[model samples]
Target: MSTFGKLFRVTTFGESHCKGVGAIIDGAPPGMELTENDIQPQLTRRRPGQSKLTTPRDEKDKVTILSGTEYGITLGTPIGLQVPNLDQRPHDYGEMDIYPRPSHADWTYLQKYGLKASSGGGRASARETIGRVAGGAIAQKYLKLTNNVEIVAFVSSVGKVAMPFVHELEDEEPVSAEFYDMLNNISQEEVDKDITRCPHPETAEKMKETIMQKSAEKDSIGGTVTCVIRNCPVGLGEPCFDKLEAVMAHAMLSIPATKGFEFGSGFQGTKIPGHLHNDAFVRKEDGTLGTKTNNSGGVQGGITNGENIYFRVAFKPAATISKDQETASYDGAWGTLAAKGRHDPCVAPRAVPIVEAMAALVIMDSFLQQQARKASAALLPSVEIHHSLLGVPPKK
Candidate 1:
């Protein structure tokens, strides 16, 4: 199924070179103020031709809200959004219809579906994610209004030019207007400027130089993005069935060209013994129990523990490049193929927003689940409410 989540489900559609792509969001809370403008910024961040590190495909990625919204507010119904695929170069992909790109989903989709859509990987294209991003924008807004939860993700590694010390990224709020401006305002013409999308000036410059050199060689590189979730409340997961981490991993891996994913203490946790790796609980100044360390990544037993949750995602270099490579045609005849497309030599930069989008979708679904549980719990006859509290409290 192309849909995900029990509540707040999202269904994505459209193809890479098609007229347009879009998503249908079901279960969004009604009456929330929504508009095309609210979702456009996220799409703009993910669109092509916006920077030097990504493809030069000059897509406006302009989105339209077709349904589920009225009078600039969500009707609490399914939100249907569309992103027209401008700057599509179907002619460039004409020959590719018969020849599958190695390491792409072409051959796999053919094997699974008996035939494949020919234009630019059809449904498998990263273009399909425009819808996800649009839908995710709505989810992001809900998280902020309901829980003050904030999610942020950034490119931390680009091939050899990895950003220093992932630990340096503390749990922070989602990007503000200033942060977005900082990202876009940086001149790509300043070839000596930053790379890897790291906020640090020197490293960004090195990363940019490396990408330019590699793109000149018609090759590509891979890297990672780390996402942080802050102010996530407790009890936002379903244990033994759909664990939060399990769902999050699935969502992250669904993005095209994603190679690996790991959350707090992931593989690195194995390097230390329990004594060092364990997150010791401590009382915080806020009068809440907090972990001295976040080895658990803010989730324990498939539920949030009111701490920062973070994870890293690795993306392989864009497979479609100008570099010549060996492959076969649809007839299984051997041949060499050099891709022709306005492809990104490195995808890490644009992927930052996508990572945050997916994280928001996942967390938003969990947030809704948490709310439903609370609403259900409050119906009990003996439930005691504290006059000082704004929400339902545990039974006394």
Candidate 2:
């Protein structure tokens, strides 16, 4: 259960308040230049105390590579990475041991294991995502180097505040050209410009104020993260069970507090008839082919359509609020409790990197799986893996 991916497998370890947490990445391609530096950016973005909207736990989260690389190059072995827990406050969370916080893993974790950590959600904490970010960074590197693929995620909304008309489209209509252009060029640097990471200046300010206001009220709020995968190669997903969008949805929902997942037309498509919802095929100037509209979000029939892959993930508000709320103790006795210790007013701002990392892991794993399938088919010349089918041009 701790492991993710089939070929590019990452087995995560450690708890939130444990000595450390990290992952062991197996099946990464050989001969890629990788080091601790390549992984730290995403970890830094994911770390707490960076903004007023998130938890104020100060952690450097410095990652260390213990194996699987030499002289900056991967040796095709398991890469072991770790980051120690710097700020552990068992005293602050001692109340959780007595009673489970509402809408948290405290109760269920205790019930299932008959045991629990003295502080935090232990393995259930968002801190556990450090390994995923690190491993996803590696995968992102591979994907970028090989295929020019780029993945970026940003806070789309917070509480009642959302990006202007982010979901304003009708079910029958295709995505707007403005959104396509905006997402096509949106970068992590641009998203990092504001604390809320909404990209739009006015909406970002509103989101920040909402978060700060909620924090002042000793409450919490939920939000959404929109992610885009630009220039993804085609024919990466396996149909039936392992569709590209399906794997992506699974990866996203696995993140802490993620409540919903949608891509392209998503739920909105159900409102319109299939005729108008369909994306018509169009030819490119380079004699290539692409869809005139990207209502399918660059994926069709469980496979990449060689267009920009975009999606949104919905994250619930942080379960732990400073305000008092009624919840049951371990023995089922109910009482009012005021949550203590550091927690985010809104988790969406910090979750931006997590969303990007998870998406990267999915794309990278899909790419490797496609590569393996191609190599296996090399014995039969009659079975040709086409450019449109595989999203890779024939090598000269």
Candidate 3:
């Protein structure tokens, strides 16, 4: 279950308080330029102790490339990556050994496995995403080098503080041109300028204030991260059960604390009339068809349409807040449970890279699957169909 993807398989290991956590990436194309440097930036961005808005758990989150590279080139073997749990304090969670934290995985994990990690949330911690971020960084590199694809995610809303554009959209209204323009041009640098990572300066300020208020209350607040994948190749998703958006939703919701996922027009499209909601196609200057309105979110009938793929992921507030709560223990004994340990009051800012990484994983896996189909089809001889209904015109 720790593994994800098909051709570009990644298996993540370790736990929140384990010796270390990382991923092993298999099926990476051989001879691509790779090194620890290529993967560290994303990990750094995802790591704790970044700012006052985030957990103060001091961790370098420095990655080490253990194998699968020679002279900075991939060897087509499994690439190994790891980041140690240097600042982890297993003692901080000592009290949780009895009562499970409310809304956390502590109880379910025990029910499923009959036992659980004594410290931290075990595999349920956001620390599990370190491996995902590292693995996604490599997938991102391949996507960037091959197709010039770019994935950017930013905190769009924190608690009730959302960007004016996002909160103001009517039920039947399509995303505005200004929103599209922002999606087309926003970069990680701009997102990183503010601790809240909302990209919009004014919204980021409000989000920061909201997070601070929640942290002060020893409670937490939930928010959303919006991600866009630009320059995605056409025809990446499967036709039926494995729709592009379906797999993307799987990937996004797999991250800890995620509560919801939506892409393109998403729920908004349901409120619009079919005539107005449809994305009418228009031929581009490049001779390929493009949609005038992207209400389809760059995908139609489970396949990509060579447009920017965008989506929003909602992350529930961090569960392990340092506040007292009324909850029952493993044996149904009710008691007050006050959790300890460093945790984010709001997870959307830190979740940005994780969202980008998961998006890359989905896109990379889909692209590789599409590429395999094309390669295999290229090897087969072409057959001329002569049926009146199905026959194609003869080659010019």
Q: TM-score for all predictions? A: 0.89, 0.95, 0.96
- lDDT (Cα, tens digit) per residue for candidate 3, span 278-346: 889898999888999898889999999999999999999999998789998778899888888899999
lDDT of 2: 0.90
- Which candidate number would show the highest TM-score if scored against the true structure? 3
Model 1 alpha-carbon miss at residue 342, Å? 1.5
Regions of candidate 1 where Cα sits further than 4 Å from its true position? 167-195, 383-396
- State the displacement of the C-alpha of residue 140, model 1, in Å, after optimal TM-score superposition: 0.9
Sort every candidate by lDDT, greatest first: 3, 2, 1
Deviation in Å, model 1, residue 324 alpha carbon: 1.0
- Local distance difference test scores for all models: 0.80, 0.90, 0.91
Residue pairs with clashing backbones, model 2: none
lDDT (tens digit, per residue) of candidate 2 on 212-306? 99999999999999999998998899999999999999999999999999989777767788888899999989888999888899999999989
lDDT of 1 by residue, 142-198 (tens): 888988877777766677776554533232312223332333343223322333556
Candidate 2: minimum summed lDDT over ten consecutive residues — where?
165-174
Model 1 gets an lDDT of: 0.80
